[model samples]
Target: MRLTALGSRLRTTAWPIPFVWTVALGLWGLSREGSVWRDEAATWQVALRSTGEISRMVENVDVVHTLYYLLMHSLFECFGPSTTVLRLPSVLAAAAAAACVAELGRRLSGNLVGLGAGMAFGLIPSVQFYLQEGRPYALVAAAAAVSTLLLVALLQGRRNERGRWIAYACMILVCGLLNWLALLILPAHMVTLAWARPTVRTWIRWASASVAATAGVMPLILFSRTQSGQVSWIPPLTWHMLIGPAILLALAGVGALLDRPGARGLSATAVGLPLLAVPQIGLVGISLFKPLFVDRYVLFSLLGLALMVGVVLGALVEAVGRRSRSSARWVLPVVVAAATVALLPQALAKRSPQSRVDDVLAAAEQVERLKKDGDAVLFVPSARRDTKSVSPHAFTGIQDIALEETPERSGTLKGVEWDAARLRTEMLARQRIILVTDAGDVSKPADSPRDRTKLATLGECFRPVVDEQVRGRRITVYVRSASDSPSRLRCSESSR
Candidate 1:
């Protein structure tokens, strides 16, 4: 009995193992070979701004990421800016999440299940993708895991119930502030409440805590509606997106069946099943109303999936133990090892530059290489201005001929550009123009009149001196055609 007690104590402290393991995984290719995608470029730019600038920018756009931007801003102030400093918070947050999953599994199931779940959390593909990302999703995932652990502790009728409830509410609040979509976890917890069938008092306490947390984030939710255009780029829901959730649900369902959780118990299925399924289904439902079904929105739900994986591993151990006790001991390690080996290629790929849609730094490098002295730069559709915003050094002596206001001063991303009439007047004075834009395959049709004008004017008045495509971005150097007189430079612009 003492030996069993010793084993239990040792297992409780085993969270650090997964924590360390996840840290190692996160640090393995921490910089992604010094690649930063456009999304991270946004983070980097906003984070480098003053708090007042961030406040103004959020009021105009991207209010959803305000808290994360402020957090990163503070980090930047303390550490200065570098790829390591940019992504280190995510690495630490992911490690904390892995540790929380391990502790949750240990308390709810066993030491082995806890360790398996914790380790499995790091290996999950979505988790791995965002694990090194310099964004708030990983931090939200960590808060969600901590909140779930607190909820499990509350359900277990542990001491310090009041304090745990407060912590739980704070965790939810943090998650919501990071990204309000994380409030979906509340419905997930509601499912757990139904499964556990807690007493009236417990339910009231849980309801109060949940309500308090939601109320804290409600103002942000309402305010963000004004900035809804940030998400307008998300396409309408399609059948193909359903395949991923369907497979996830099917796998979790099998794990639930294998665990066969008892009614009204804080069993693995009781917590994990609801955690895994409810948020995903809830997001799908939201998508039905508005196309907001991004997989990363409910990334916290991966914890539920990891817990279920642990249950599945536990089931395998039990089945194998019936045949040979010694063999049962090998079940988890062997399975984890085999899974790791199978995922080796994917793991390496996630650490590569090609893992993302585009590399902002690589594009900046292309600008540095192709740029000649006194060349003026133009960003097609304007958003590509992020390349210059993220790497201002590469753009030294390069004029943004059309920019009317800087992004920081204008309280907007990508800054403000002159009207097409003024833009053409400005462009006519420039001898060499460096055009930075998306490559042909990824470039969207120029929607705004200004963008259309930029394209048409360049096509009519300039000849391509050098054009190169690298890492999903295109750099073209256009020298004004001497044969083209100002009369011939008359380019038509879209009326709208």
Candidate 2:
């Protein structure tokens, strides 16, 4: 009796132990990963660049969210711009999001529901992946959670309660600044509000505030639109990818409709709509135009997925209790165990060292040793023109003048035509030229054999210096004929 009473007292507290456990799990998963992949590398590069130069860089490149960049810029300034430092903000943001989910769950349902939702979020594979990445996706996820929570509070407002309205507006604006996808969450809000039957005056105030906020965000939308044109690799969007999320969403909707009055239906819709809408829209948009659907772009939806899963599990437990009251004791544990089993693979993958940015840096370091002074590194064939599909932007340690076909296609450097003579002349004027080509490009059968022979002809003009492996692919470096000249002298000193 004494032990049971103590357990009950502990469960009644605001900060339950299960909520703490869920947060710990999220933090652990995020900290296990150490790699800053390609897009992450691009984010780091942008953040490292001077704030004064950011607007100019964004004009030249394709960056959608200026606010995220600005926040990362500030973070880099304080943290000294290493991969770990660059990624820390996202990690913390994701952890905070898990906490917020639990808090929201507690407010809507009870401690058990909140704890389950938080744990589900913490264990999600996609959530773990984005939280460990050095990008804005994790922040977006956090903002989405905060926005959902605020919206819920607003819907549940009492007579003479104006504070929740202000809070809701502020959360929406902050989410909008975080990413354009925040706009996607608005339809969910509108649907929920219409179902809730709020007063006409409240609706008018919300709509007016929303219009003003949209007007405020117009400059950013224009800037993003201008940058979108530079991306040439966007693919068509499709409907097939929407099937799984859509089915799940329908189930969630049914669950909401079946829910008892007051908290159940409202909570179900709050979690279900965003999860269903963002990805469904994103995937469909991607099928039509390739630029739109990126896996990282839907990181915010993981929160909704977690919530939906938690609600379903909670409802299942309730159902089981109605059939066999004795089974209720085992239901929560069984749900947690099943979730852990499903999430094990993703949790382990996040911690693997093979997924790190240091691998690319190491490869670049190897290339550096073989080059003489006045060397230019050529990026052969070039990457996809779309910013969305471009290779991860992280640089290895090797620094060389990059060659490409179009500046728009390559994020960091301008593209140069494949002129062997011009390249040789540049190398002779300097002392060495290192040509790095993706082996996958070489395997393609469409290129003229003569054009394909460019590397061989260029190799003949210079001495083979070094060939290094980066992420399992060989990148060869070559020295110019005048390898012993003063240009080499300058190159040697500069490389050091």
TM-score of every model versus the real structure: 0.95, 0.77
Residue pairs in steric clash, candidate 1?
none
Query: Model 1 residue 285 lDDT?
Result: 88
lDDT of 1: 0.87
Worst 10 residues of 2 by lDDT: 383-392
lDDT of each: 0.87, 0.58
**What local lDDT does model 2 show for residue 143?**
77
lDDT of 1 by residue, 125-200 (tens): 8898898999999999999999999998888888999999999999999999999999989988988888888999
Q: How well does candidate 1 match the true structure in TM-score terms?
A: 0.95
lDDT of 2 by residue, 1-496 (tens): 0122222332554234444554455456443333434456567656765666666556666456567778888888887767667666777778777777766655655555555667677677777777777777888878777877766666667444466566666666666676665666666667667766777886886786566666666677677776675545455444555576677567556646533335525555455555556555655554474456555666776666666655665566667767775675477678878878787776776766455433334334444555454456555443311111122232233333424344433333233354554444444444555665444422243253333444654554567666655542346767655437764453332332
